[model samples]
Target: MSVEVLSFGCRLNAYESGAMRELAVGAGHAGTVLVNTCAVTAEAEKQAAQAIRRLARERPGVSVVVTGCAAQIAPARWSALPGVARVIGNADKLKPEAWALDAAPAPVSDIMAARGVAAYPVADFANRARALIEVQQGCNHRCTFCVIPYGRGPSRSAPVGAVVAQVRAALEAGCQEVVLTGVDIASYGPDLPGAPTLGQMARRLLALVPELPRLRLSSIDPAAIDDDLWRLLGNEPRLMPHLHLSLQHGHDLLLKRMKRRHSRADALAVAARARRLRPGIALGADLIAGFPTEGEAEFAATLDLVGEAGLQFLHVFPYSARPGTPAARMPQLPMAVRRERAARLRAAGAERAQQFYAARMGEEEAVLLEHPDRGHTEHFCPVRLAAPAGARGQVLRARVTGADARGLLAEAA
Candidate 1:
């Protein structure tokens, strides 16, 4: 094993893992394992720690370097763990010099003080049908429940030229789709000169790279939708009509407590506008089931918002308190309560998703084949091809024949 990166977290982390692999191999480190951890929830942290212990025991002598959000936030904890050779912070992961075999055990700096965004140019994602481009890094917001700010530091965006070049590289590498991802994509360009918005970046990228077949954006804050993005939804044919919103809760008070910028009305309006512009667009969201100080009514409002917002794909997270966050200091909910509410929310989301897939039955869609026999439609709905659809990474049109709890069943049309 030359280099293997165990990535945990968002699409941004997955993209970075590729860069880490490249950096590790280039640094002459073979049989090395890098664990990229997440700091989003306590469970995520626990899993990372467990993996580290397991790797040490099973692999014995392979170098185990911990990096990413979890490592950045608490380097001492990971450094103390046995068999951990080195701990790299989020700020230094992409730097080639940082991975030097003879370097110190742990080299972490003040993440909040870091300002510049470094470009990690990945030629292609290993065996991925689509490529992901990290347009920006870090978040500026101090959401009471989020530890990402500390883990990732301040928001910084890559220059427009660098982003365009990355997309060009992805396209030239035979990738059909490219996804623009970041910590807070909506907060892009604020730290740079001229203050370009994410919408502007998307337009520039699409206009400059016409050969690019499809483009998608990862989770975006509801409060950050600008006029330019709305125009893309209304006009850009190549831009996929699917968006995953970063809406933490439904009730205004709970959202306020979470320090989220968008309200219930704002979320509803954004979903409505997206559909109005692009008919039959799929709207997905990230919703937390139980937050600190959340009452029964607050949780109920979140369940109702799924219908009111017309959300089709729901990423439900049961709130897990992280140390040093404002929410963690507040009155807490029982562990059982959080898990129960999460299940209920997931059930509701499943019902809505089945309805959405059922409605697509008999319609023709251009599905991007991620697997020989499976693919995802333009709306991001999963489809199982009736026959092998050529090869992986080929996009083909298929007629939806039926719907199941999993997704749509399609045959070559």
Candidate 2:
């Protein structure tokens, strides 16, 4: 009769799923099936809906509750689905009482009205090597191609004290690393008391949690980095040297149409600055392909950005037009064209990644072994090693031996 959670989308959702599990179990609704969804792309929502139907069929008679960005934005649509017993908003999903039978069958609320983030207390991440601490919630900017702002509400910061406590709890629970995550992490703290910057938050967290061994950040906007955080990139070795940026497009015109804040020049500058501050740091970015008016020349700029930005890890998304987004109303590109451009970007990303791994073939790195056969380096590059059974969840020194399309191969040092 235990509650089961099926999570999809970002690492933040994964963290929230864990919290939801705790809430469900604590509320004594052990037989409920929770389908946490993502609404980033139309395809993501489609998959979530499909999964929901499959789960309901397989686990008959159980109350199937759907939540997450997809459900939050379109509660009526999901509620009408065959097997869904209820639909909850992103804002209400974390509340313990929301899991009770007396809770509304469709508990969607005005997520935009939420002034602050509710701290969903979690004791542990059952099988994670690292824990995610959500320091912010929602987004203030309305990127032309995004629907997440409406789903998540305005930006709200968890008090710095609450964040520190969460990290401390994670460390005490034996997590090796803690990743600070949010929808738009770089925009953190704008709504809080002092309107402290993300950089200031990072500095304070590290300084206050002196025993914290590794602190990582989720995807950030290049335009929002503050001076204090930038300095820490150079001085703090514990602030893991991997930065994943949200760089939607490489061409200025496309970027402008997408309502992005940074220019291509700004991206290149950040890449250079990261490397200068921390040698051998891994740079990752999220890039999209085949925007409405993107020409071959525009596509070429994005392809060239793989090298120009020195991106070692890339997440390339084929543009999918969401119904309400501004880009959706613009002249749409053919699906085939979008996918082909995405493939090209991925190929370039692979080439750069291999080059980065090859350069580290003879170097020594501290690998955090998440599994018996796999782990990642401080730069967040995947490394394959035959780790001892006892070494899982432990960080060990390793010497790299080779690189291939898969990842770097290493031997325990």
Candidate 3:
């Protein structure tokens, strides 16, 4: 079987797909591939469907398996689609070996952390410059809008020691940077014996690997950051200064309806503190434009607050309630309304992003040289340089040449 895996949705899906690929190869069906499914939104469903059709056209009757949030939510829908030989829910992931086309993998008697921690593969991905290590999986918080916790099993955290081991392994494998990812990364280490928080995990990792080149964090819940975390992050050069905070709504009333723990003031306080503690820090945010009963006044307040928050890059997405969540029962804005709101927020975000890039025109920022092909700036701005291939790993002080429709350009300073 000629196996090729396609993943959709969050980093957890990537981790699960990676593990599935590893086990399939070990089962003597080395060539067989897996098609991972995603279910973040309705758009994700359409994309997964299109991908399935493309895979079926390429190789008919291959052992195509679909799994993840999409499959979990609507297995019959995916199973009915062409080219998918099997559909596995979260329960099926309990034993990845069983899904193999032929022979099952031998159970490992002695394992690190727990037996299922490595349920997903983490091998043969040496080509990428950045590796995302999913430190935890699943979410416990019942955020009214999210479907992830239901899609994944009860919240599970990889062992802290196991996570550190993975980090060390990725570093040894020549990865330039490691991004700690998960559905709810702030809830990391909760399922383990000790239940250390994300801040503690980060502190421990920084202490353990004193010389690790770069440590990047995925978006974190504002409620999770504490005084200890801010203090630890203040002088840590290895820890990336860029922080992506998820602030879905700006109104305290809307936040309450969304079931988020933090209030509007709470989020603003965290962002303000992070900026004050770290000067010239790049702060990013994820904002939802339209949710149930989010009137024009509420939306306007959100826009006002976003500007006041001093956000650099904003990922503005309109709300879509998934089934099995509390928000689905709530009155939904029409598709036209959703689309219109999304467009307005997106336009605002683009203007803000342009301003941010423009401000960095004369400043010298550390560029983590990704590859001869493409790379990203520390602030998540896309960058391309006139430098040579040797500039892959070295941090180059690049002078911003220009910011076009595509991205910012730089010359070696």
Which candidate order results from sorting by TM-score in descending order?
Answer: 1, 2, 3
> Which of the two candidates, 2 or 3, achieves a greater TM-score against the reference?
2
Residue-wise C-alpha lDDT for candidate 1, range 255-349, written one tens digit per residue: 99999898899999999999999999999999998798889999999999999999999998999898999999999999889999999989999
Per-residue C-alpha lDDT of model 2 across residues 83-198, encoded as one tens digit per residue: 78888899888888887766756558999998787776578664667889989999989888999988889899988888998888888877789899989989888788999999
* Model 1 lDDT, full chain set: 0.89
TM-score each candidate: 0.98, 0.97, 0.90
Please list all clashing residue pairs in model 1, or write none if there are none: none
Backbone collision count in every prediction?
0, 1, 7
Root-mean-square deviation of each candidate, in angstroms?
1.1, 1.3, 3.7
Predictions in order: lDDT: 0.89, 0.88, 0.73
User: Which residue pairs overlap in candidate 3's backbone?
Assistant: 3-31, 3-32, 3-33, 4-33, 18-121, 19-120, 19-121
- Those runs of model 1 whose alpha carbons end farther than 4 Å from true positions after fitting are none
